[model samples]
Target: MTQHRPDTLSHAPLGRESAYPEHYDAGLLYPIPRAVNRAPLGIEEGALPFVGEDEWHAFEVSWLNAHGKPIVAVARFRLPAQSPHLIESKSWKLYLNGFNQTRFESRQAVVDTLLRDLAHAAGAPVAVELLDVDDAALAVTRLPGECLDDLDIEVTDYTPRAEHLAVGEEIVEETLHSHLLKSNCPVTGQPDWGSVLIRYRGPKLDREGLLRYLIGYRQHQDFHEHCVEHIFTDLMARARPERLLVLARYVRRGGLDISPWRATPGERPPEPLRLSRQ
Candidate 1:
């Protein structure tokens, strides 16, 4: 492994030239300190405004057994929002690829090593699980709620505008979603596509305005977790909803997809759903 250390996302090796290493190297993983992006959201000091966790599904995990036979498994990692850092996606890919030729004593041992390594990289405890492809769920599902894409509206702005989230007193509960939630990577400027679902109670949010606000993220550049937190904070500040649940499911890049979920205090997260695009 190289001794180089990168401090920012742009300095990371995602868009840079690289080849897979021949051995397992824990140092291959890079972590982005949460404070870097959280600072801009005015959450640099105190407690986070929401409760949730970021879920990662790795679809391309493989390694070798003691007999030189190939072993394959899917991995799921859940990183809490309170973590001090988030693992860089490309670095994660490199780290996983490093395990290609390595042998483990047992699946549990592999799981334990992965848990320890990822948790250390994230600066927080991360829950991890390994599943066989035969037993893993593969159903393609859509976000549950009303589809806002059918709304008739004209959109010209492609930047986040908190003013677009208008709400009125109605005390009704509804779930709204849009498949047009797209953003760009802060480093490589690569387009990130995803679907977002908003479930809330209190004053009803203007569906047209909500769709416009989601569309505004077209040119936005930020991390997936930061984007979800940004949306949650915006809604809390503007609509003042009594209850809110925000989720962003970005498509898989580099054989991995990230799902960030935030909800009102004491609320359990919904079932994990896989989409065709994921």
Candidate 2:
């Protein structure tokens, strides 16, 4: 195992150069290596080295073969949280494009097969929608909220780090912010940029410690959702707050901006709001 030093920002390089270009085809689908399938869990539940929700990013998506010619098929899909299989989004995107040169008997067949594959990977049923040009308007919705640009917070540094926090305090309110923003595709290492927000209620958290830990991910490689989950779990253990929420709004990549939210059972996430750069 390699130990990451706080001062060594360059120690862990991000996956940037591998980012796929916008015009890349979507027919070339592939699977993640079995070795990398290790569940990104820590030594124990709520441990500091927590695995975030963004690790499940995947899409085996594609469009129908209109006119028997390969064209980009706009697709929208939703995976159930109950699924055991989690598709890596970067891999999904690549997988979808892998089909650009391939042929399908019908759009329904394509959709059905994709649903089965994604469901298997997610360990739950998945839904997919093929969008026509007219349906583009309804295909995607903008996230809810004010832009995060110009939304600045005081930065501080703290120490005495532990692997996790023990649950104790009943958090009434809290705010966590980080400016260490960088975006990179899981497969191509292309940069996907954005900001993150964490709010909860419980005991008073070490503001400086939280900020330092958030900044520590400056060079870390992972998806937006995964990053937020990692933060949420880490704080849950370290701060042991009563209620917690994690939200991450990433900048647009390939005409799409992904924001993921997760909380304890019965917890609700705020509506997706647009941030400044969004």
The prediction achieving the highest TM-score against the true structure is: 1
Q: Write the per-residue lDDT of candidate 1 for residues 1-278, one digit (tens) a residue.
A: 45435357666767788888889998888888888887887875358888889999898898887787889988888999888888889989999998889998778878998999888788889999888876546557778888999899999999999999998877788888899999999878999999999998879898899899999999999989999989998999899988999998999998999999887787545685888899
Per-residue CA lDDT of candidate 2, range 1-278, in tens?
11223222233223224444343332322223211222453423223232223312222344436566754445656554333334444445555555655667788877777777666555457677666645433334443333333434554422223342343345457555554556455545566676667667788765544545655555566656556656676777777666777767676564455666666565665542555565
Clashing pairs in 1: none
Question: How high a TM-score does candidate 1 get?
Answer: 0.96
User: For model 2, what is the error of residue 127's alpha carbon versus the real structure, in angstroms, after optimal superposition?
Assistant: 3.3
Off by over 4 Å in 1: 1-6
User: What is candidate 2's TM-score against the reference?
Assistant: 0.59
lDDT score at residue 195, model 2, on the 0-100 scale: 67
| lDDT of all predictions | 0.87, 0.51
Estimate candidate 1's RMSD in Å: 1.4
User: What TM-score fits each model?
Assistant: 0.96, 0.59
Model 2 misplacement above 4 A: 1-62, 65-74, 80-85, 98-110, 131-171, 174-180, 183-192, 206-209, 223-225, 254-258, 272-278
